[model samples]
Target: MAPPSFVSQEEFHAFHTIDRKLYTLLVINLWRDPVESMQVIALWLWLERVGFKNVVQKILSLPYILTNELADEAVTCLNVINNDQLASLTEGNDTPLMQSLIDRDLSLQFFDKHRLIATQGITRIVNEVCIRALRDIMQHAIERNAAQSLADSQKVISHSLQQPMVQPGLPQVGFGPDADVELPWTQESEVPPDDRTMFVTFSKGYPVHEWEVREFFTRAYGDGIESLHMQEVPPDEQSLFARIVFCSESAIEIILSGMSKAKFTINGKHVWARKFVPKRLKPSLPAAPPVNLPV
Candidate 1:
């Protein structure tokens, strides 16, 4: 379904400073969450823009152009700044990574800039009121924007708003029946009791939760997984592994074949599955661990 367009293409083509900033913030939020549907983003964008009481469009000075080397350093350090709350995490006279690279004041200013933007942008949205208000706004926009006929816009907004958040993980829908109950990722078992179980290995850094493991398989091979157990790799170790017990040997073979159909990834890196073998028989070095979660 097509998302409602509150700001017509004509409105955006003629966006003043404030409208542009709101639009930019909406884009930032979009990047931060790919799962977020477009209609919800448009609603939130309109909500924040109207909720804030600001009229005068202030012309601010442009950002300083950095030397190639300085720019590289700034980008690298700031890219590592995963949390917006890093400013609070720093100690007395202990600068954040941003401060170390760009010096304290600019770091603080940079932090404040994004901080104010996030706070002013998303903070106004209180959950209970947001939905009711958003419906009204989208309805009004649909009515006003003769270009957006009622049939399409209504479906988009309803679906976008009603779509459940994927939660901290996706569903454990597929995989065969081997172990009737799902096993803990850290099951104390030294080996799979049966041939139906297989191990999937990927580079570790991000927490490989049971649901994530289940979701990967479901996406890669369709679900019927009976049980999944994640073996705890050393925290500092590079490679991560999980044991998935399928209902049939065919399920294990389908994944171990590593064909395009079975191939899948965690954070874009390829994951390989094989029949569970004892650590004593298999010899492999630890792979590099993931440094940070994608922002």
Candidate 2:
């Protein structure tokens, strides 16, 4: 019998090859009881259709079936099932037993099975494609939000650096040499007064030495720093703090000018600097000499 017209030449050739093998096997057993041979052929055809339907269902159910092209390919592959060949196998048998085997409605069942499998396969492919598309959209949205957040943070930092620093309850004073400065007292005489010192703090978990501080300031301010001292930390503390004493008090003003917070990037670490402010001493209470008469 001729191959199905819907399939390609290559597909038809493959189908014809398999069909010839099956036909040869049936002819080999044709000399046996005719009724038993026909029954065997009917059973074989039913099993083949059932197995093909099962395999098609499994492949279509996979989540990776992401396009309509794949569904089209699956339908093309299924078209290789040629019912004409199956019908031809029972052509010469005119007995009532052979007619009974053909009339069992196997062709109707196969047609229904093929239509159902095709519908389910197309539905699964469409669903997987939609899911993947939504996943890509959500990923793009997350990346866009992250990029916007980064831009906003940079703008905030730039704006903050442009504004002048304001210390609450302290008068806004000029950095000029003639400006009157109130120097905060300190117990350590070796360290310069608060007006000439810049209190420096390093980012936690970074190792910093005195030489780095001296080198950083001398390079920036042209040898204006008088002394650099790294504070001795307690065993429990991990933070590093330093006292930078410049020869001229103007160095502190120059570094902190026009910025709300003086910050520097040293050796890829963030370091903050500010004019040193000491804790004020409270005034002494008046004597109770007026209460001597009552005693």
Model 2 TM-score, all chains together: 0.31
List TM-score per model, in order: 0.26, 0.31
Best by the lDDT measure: 2
- Model 1 has a clash total of 11
Q: Global lDDT of each model?
A: 0.41, 0.45
Candidate 1 ranges beyond 4 A from true positions: 1-193, 233-239, 258-263, 279-295
| Model 2 regions lying over 4 Å from their true place | 1-192, 234-239, 283-295
Q: Write the per-residue lDDT of candidate 1 for residues 74-110, one digit (tens) a residue.
A: 3322332324544543322212222223222433344
Question: Which 10-residue span in candidate 1 carries the lowest summed lDDT?
Answer: 58-67
Residue 64 accuracy (lDDT) in model 2 = 26
Residue 265 of model 2, lDDT score:
71
What lDDT is reached at residue 244 by model 1?
77
Distance from true position, residue 135, model 2, in Å? Answer: 56
